[model samples]
Target: MDILSDLWLGAQTAFSVWNLLYCLLGVFLGTAIGVLPGLGPTATIAMLLPVTFGLPPETALIMLAGIFYGAQYGGSTTAILVNLPGESSSVVTALDGYQMARNGQAGTALATAAIGSFAAGTVATVLIAFFAPALSAVALTFGPHEYFSLMVLGLVASIVLASGSLLHAVGMVLFGLILGLIGTDINSGEMRFTFGRFELADGISFVIVAMGVFGLGEILSNLENEQGRSVTLSKVTGLMPTRADLKRMVAPVTRGTLIGSVLGILPGGGAMLASFAAYALEKKSSKTPERFGKGAIEGVAAPEAANNAGAQTSFIPMLTLGIPSNPVMALMIGALIMQGIQPGPSVIEEQPVLFWGLIVSMWVGNLMLLVLNLPLIGLWVKMISIPYGFLFPAIVAFCAIGVYSLNNATFDIWLMAGFGFAGYLLRKLDCEPAPLLLGFVLGPMLEEHLRRSMLVSRGDATTFFTRPISAILLLLAVLLIVSILAPAVRQKREEAFTDED
Candidate 1:
């Protein structure tokens, strides 16, 4: 009842004419970015960070949060129509969604994704409202050792769940960690991996790397393939799935929502892990697993739901503990910091209106996505008819402009182009980029926590293993390692990642 009253108060704040307008603007821009094939929430948000400086904190946050979730909703449109995923979370969607489009079931595929997302998002929001406070209390008890172990688990899970060879994924993670170490040492103020370059002394901008690796890299990879055609959105008949389709999807959606909610609360799992895990679980449990890559509706629904749910729940850690689970959340934290608002346990109590207002706005944002997505999907489908040759060049140009816009520096454009080419080579070698992103985000934080934990323990490493939460997390990490080493599990994992024949 208290939660409901708080939510009502929040709605009052979020539904104001001005606030709603910002929400709409964010969603509108987010959809545009998602449809553009390579741009994502990260790049889009990073680009707009400067503009929000003048807005009130709640309004700024509402807009940014709207973009984050709105992009998730819109990302599926391209994944279904063009086999292009705007976000890593949408990668699994591309597998079955693009197949469904080719098979003339684009409408059904998209409808399932949108509806499932709406359902899961609604449920997750309620869960978050009730659970976040409790979870925040739990988080308050965590010491530096516990936090360090959690970070380690997060890094391990990211590497293990990445979509490529185990060794390759680990290598990519290490590379990202190295990239993360490029800035001056925060504790010592000593230059580390700047390589004596003035521009690098501040470390590579998150915007630069995200734009280069995902945005420009996608364009360069597209250029490597001369097959330049998207599935035509000529015939979309069904807007609703049949009872039979619904029956098949029910279990997957339920399981996915559960899995995503739990994993999303864990630092580093976020939307990408949730979506991938949901798909993997669906495949494992399916009677006709072979149907997955060839346009299984469950594949579309389960992962879409899980990803959105994960994206929502990921906010819990950031809101409660002041720890960002992913880069997007990190950006949010940055936004909050800019406003002189520290995200921690006290936030909900100290600023009830802001906290509740944000929660209410999420519900509003979800509703807007459903209303907007259902109608706009057809428009998105039509974009498939655009020629890939023309599209790739535009994508390349967009990447250059977006990356350069950060500091108005041409250096970023060149850097992105270099990384884009490098990304192409990595993809050719069957390496995964998702783990790299996770590692880059977590590496510095991990080092800081590790050092802090060690100092608190008087330089004794045993503290990490002795703490109950830390011990459990370490055990889970060990289990993950053992599972990867297990011959049977290894074989299945290998087969799962190998492109469906």
Candidate 2:
């Protein structure tokens, strides 16, 4: 009854004409950008963030949420049709999907991916509606000590992410922390890293950082490594799967949904992790494992299901615990802050409309993708043929315009350009910008909690160890660090990420 009431409340907000239209536009643009290779959700969302500034918080968030999962749906289209994954999460989908295409089963693979993704998204939506509230209730009790420990655990856990090079990830996080420290000190009211510029008093805006690093940085990187796309199937006919194909999809979809839901809740876990893990699981569990990369329908179905489920469920931490599971969620935290809404346990109680509305809109957006994507596959395939040279100028112009609109200041634009160049250099060095973004987003919160905990304990450092929940969280962080350092475990982690594709 409570959930039913909550859903009703959410539906009211999500189903408004303007809200529905925003959601549609988001999914449509998300699919279009996703269909084009090399544009991931983080960059797409970052690029489009300025467009959402005029809308209400709930509507803006609903639209952004649509773009995220819509990208997941659209990615499979590229993988199956062009043998080029549109998003990183769709990389595994390309393995069997492309093989199926070559064997004249392109339509069948696309159908399987769509259906599995719909099933997984449907289930994951309900799971979030049910699970997020409980998680938030638990988080409501977290004190400064517990919160500080949790942030430490998050930073440590992120170091072990499938992102390349543990040392590079750690260094990026520290770099982000240093950047986050540039602002004035909240407690002491002293300038920390202003460097004699009055403009630096408020520190760098997260918006500028995100736009430069993900938006401009992505475009720069893509231009650097741009390649021609070879389409395997320009014309697809059969959009329906056979009954046997449906049967094969069922079990894998179910298992993937479950795996994705669980992993989606973990620190640093997102759609990317769930898809890779799901593909690996199906491979390891298959009776004829050799068929995985050779047009196996289950290979297409399982990861498709998992990525959608993971993409949906990854909202749990951001909505409830105020911790981001991925870079996109980190940006969502910034979005909430810009909306004057803090992302934490109190969000549910203070802004039920924003919370429940977002959850409900995901299902609506998923349904829209399922209905619209299959019929538009041809259009998406055609989009891949368009040269990147045509799109680059638009992206660059938009980045400059968006940053300027933030505060109507040209300085932010210049700052974004600098970060874009820096991000490009870092990528060349094999350093992932994800951990750095996470660190930038969480650093201030971590410092605030640490200072609060210290203040509460009269500057006693042992207070974190004395609190039961805090101690357990810190211990888990320690174990994670220790495990990553062990040579055997480290090797295994590397192997897991070393996919054949």
Candidate lDDT (C-alpha), each = 0.79, 0.89
Note each model's CA RMSD in angstroms.
4.1, 1.5
Once fitted onto the true fold, the runs of candidate 2 whose alpha carbons sit more than 4 angstroms away are: 493-501
Write one digit per residue (lDDT tens) for candidate 2, span 433-458.
99999899999999999999888999
Worst 10 residues of 1 by lDDT: 225-234
Estimate candidate 2's alpha-carbon lDDT, on a 0 to 1 scale: 0.89
The alpha-carbon root-mean-square deviation between model 1 and the true structure, to one decimal in Å, is 4.1
Q: Which candidate achieves the best lDDT against the true structure?
A: 2
Q: Count of backbone clashes for each model?
A: 0, 0
True-structure lDDT of candidate 1: 0.79
